[model samples]
Target chain A: MKTYLKLAAPMALAAALAPVPAAAAWRLVDQGETRKVARSTLVVTAPEEWNRATERPSSRSEVWTQDGIALSELTFYAKIKDGETLFKRRQGKRNPLPEFDKDMLPTDLVEWYEDTANIVLGGSLFEIVEVTPATLAGYPGVHLRYSYTGGDNVARLGEARVAIIDEKLYLISFEAPRLHYFDRYIAGVRAMMDNARFK
Target chain B: MKRLLASAALIGLFAQPLLAQETGDETPEEKPLPSAHGYEPQDDLEKGLWYEMDEAEKSLKESRFLIEEPALNAYVRSVLCQTVGDERCAATRLYLLRTPQFNASMAPNGVVLVYSGLLLRMRDEAQLAAVLGHEFTHFEKQHSLRIFRQIRTKTDLLSWRSVVPVRLPYPAGMATQLAVLGSVYDFNRDMEREADAGSIEELVRAGYDPRAASAIWSQLGAEMDATAEERGHRSDKNRNGGLFATHPRSTDRMGRLAYLAREAAGDGAGELYRGAEEYRAAIGPWWAQLIEDQIALKDFGGTEYLLATLAGDDPLGWTGDLLYARGELYRARAEDGDFAQAADFYRQAIATGEFPAESWRGLGLSLMRAGQKPEGQAALRSYLELRPEAPDAALLASMAGEAAS
Candidate 1:
């Protein structure tokens, strides 16, 4: 079923100016079972138990979180069509998310993430700590690590692995508070990435 | 507090010229100012307003987004002081914020926040002075106090005042405060006209080109038009419309200011300085950061217009950065044949021999997207060689291996 996720206020203003509840719905995903992610053309086994957001799914992406989205989030993207953004709601803003392109390089992807966080996530400060290439789902991909201070003045750390395969884009990303949440769950995220494979 | 008292003393010293002007003395040595120097809240109502603004100012001081560049800060302060006069300038404090919107605001308590976006758009010191003078007028005229009293009459001022300092992400608090300030104390057309006219007079008196005042608004209008065209919308509906529309349209403002400038110029001044070189030198170090902020907004149309404008001013000095920016823009736009265009620009940047290492990576990706695998692989190899420890290095190596086969 098609779902509509309405971000009632601008992302930049929502967290700091007005604390609006993220109108996302979730489902429980038990550990050790390979499950198909929403709308994506791939399936993966969870390393452990986690909560997956069922709201705001496109034909190519889904989100899971060990804690809440504000504290930590894991997102998956599969076969995102060219000219489509990873997040649906972001397509409406004055500075909307950049569209995905098959020809995008790792650097381009990094820029896309940066723009998304700054313009869509309402991050006041954003910096890319590092970017390196990696193999994703047995395909050439790039890994990006970044730090951003959001409008709420909370510092967050994020990491993403992205690849373009079969003329379509695929990505997995995780973000959490840099203080503790990032270190708390990064090993699990890495393990999940290690186990992930395209179906 | 000492600055305020000193301002009060200077008011009397300067009051004679103002009184003379009031009596219609043509070419008076000094113009009459609307508010005396060393202004303080006259009553509890004004005091309450200042209290709220003072808190907001404190938060602003602590804001992470404030650009802490000493040289840039000093340069901007010098311009503001030149326009407002050093004695009166002491009553105001300027905060250079790193926001990527073309906005500047002055709170009642002498806090002036200038966004980097405005700095990016400014062509010369005269333009910067014009904007500063306009904002200073807002403070000098006590517009915020007037608006606060009006809001107090209509709504509970205490509730509104409390909300101003809510912790919000990035610029959310600042944006909220600005939004609330705008909603409650929306400057009427007459106020804007006064500020605009006052700023022109200030520019002329400071020996700046009065014409530069009109040029800024005109350029802003043109940029908005370009943005509208790119977004397939009517010019009237452009996002920059709110601020520009709130004031007099650029055409009308430009016409009036040009007339005022002509009148001011009639006294036979040979030439007025725009201080273009001085302005560039002061802002040069921050250009890359400012440009990065603009591009991060992902407004292709606006970014392209801004880069083109800057490039037009100093093509040789800005060539490498301009070419790299253009390449990034085209790549981000990702339209048909854009990859080829991006590749071309990246190559041009690389040829400059002063390019950022990212240019090599960009060229590699652009070439690969354009279906020139061998050339693309070679370029990527060059990038890997240069920035071997880049976070995405392994990915590039993998891509190169794939291309080799």
Candidate 2:
């Protein structure tokens, strides 16, 4: 999965996915469940995103997590390889995203997305149900229709329609409401993805 | 009363071995795994986490009796300690916490402490094993002290958003650091990548679906996302805890683990070790509380994800009650005038047979919210007739009055 993070999505995906699921093997890999996105890497990777996302190119709208009443931000770096693995920089003032202290900390879809990116390349059939074939950018891709179920409710309070394009496992994914968001932004998403090349 | 007594007695009696004399690793060969960065099991950090595997054994002996209800205790311990009934894995001693939160932890000494909320959330053995697998990797890879040292140092953090400056005083005390640790206890980023990889194998070795890891991540994501939405934020930090902090992210792990789970799929004897009915039967007492707690917290996403996961095991007929619960959740939401959407949930509840009485009441509530007074009145009446002694009878009746012509 970290391999996919390298933008060598396909090859990294293959390496991450091909292994057998075994506890011993996991011991062989590494162990830390703290997962947060590194924005510096993203910013470094794509400077245009800041301007495009908030329409505030001049004022950098650094992403901040709303913790209780405060919005704290980090100088995050996503491009770190095992070269300077997490262990080397485990302690410092800069708190990692998704603090690993609590037993059940909140994780967003991005973490799952990164994890699944590796899975997608792992060679198992990630069956997409209720989806259609679509061109996202120049890369041929598929639209995924997924539903989320909640324990407290009978009606699925959530539905996600995601548009995606993949070339050798480097995925360009766009998530929006199945009813409107996906349809509305798919073209822009496609263009953005098409415009993107490996950084 | 009997169950409680038996539990107390077990806690008292079984706690003996925990107090008994035990041995430690005096020899170089017997040293515990080092948890410090660049430290190996044979190193000093390992010494910190494994001060006593023997003491862990002692604790297990003492704690065995803590869960007095033999069957429940034994079954739960079996699920957590035993490696999916696999002969290849050793049974580790797991501690039971008295906390009511949703969580579990693994001591470096192989002591696994499971939270009651975990049992409440899991619908089957596979899901339980899925979580256990993640923890098992912690022990197997000896990550206990690795993270401990990482937190002590207060290190690397990851985020998709731009890094904003957080002003901190020089050399803060352990007190503020501990609290900050709770919020931002940074573990080595490598450990996160390790867990992602380890979770894959742990699930496979345990005879559970490794993919459950990805599913769990997705479930976790939805839960947090939903809670944030409930609490009013497009990007809330309450939910992005440990796993997300470690590194890469669940997104990448999904792809990595998917590859891992696939290998064992073709193995002839590989059936995921889970049965929803059996899971419910084991922890029947805690289900309602778990559902209610998560709901009260208004974590619709996690709630929904949990229900869906249970529903996926619908072959075991466990989804009906969950479906009903979901309907009630929507009724509670009632935000941005989503009453009609809540009404649809009631219909599904009826379709699934979850909570007949409440689903009817919720249907009425949704109807009234959507301004269908006549139908809402009839629905409330039906609810009252169905469960005249319901806990919310007064409220229901008042609502009924408002809806009535």
Winner by lDDT:
1
DockQ of every candidate structure: 0.26, 0.01
lDDT of 2 by residue, B256-375 (tens): 666666765556525566566778787776565456544443345556656766566464544546766777666544455557877876777677655556778778767876778789
Residue-level error in angstroms, candidate 2, position A169: 56
TM-score for chain A, prediction 1:
0.82
Per-residue lDDT of candidate 1, residues A50-142 (tens digit): 898766455566778887777877878787877777666533534466677766766677777777666765433778888777767787777
Global lDDT for candidate 1?
Answer: 0.68
Model 2 chain A poorest ten-residue lDDT run:
A99-108
* lDDT by residue (tens digit), candidate 1, B276-296: 999989998888788777777
Local accuracy of candidate 2 as per-residue lDDT tens digits, A3-94: 11211212211122221123211111012212222232121223122111211111211221112101111112232221122112212222
Best by TM-score: 1
- Per-prediction TM-score, chain B alone: 0.79, 0.62
- Name the TM-score of candidate 2: 0.46
**lDDT, candidate 1, residue A165?**
83
Q: What total of clashing residue pairs does each candidate reach?
A: 17, 94
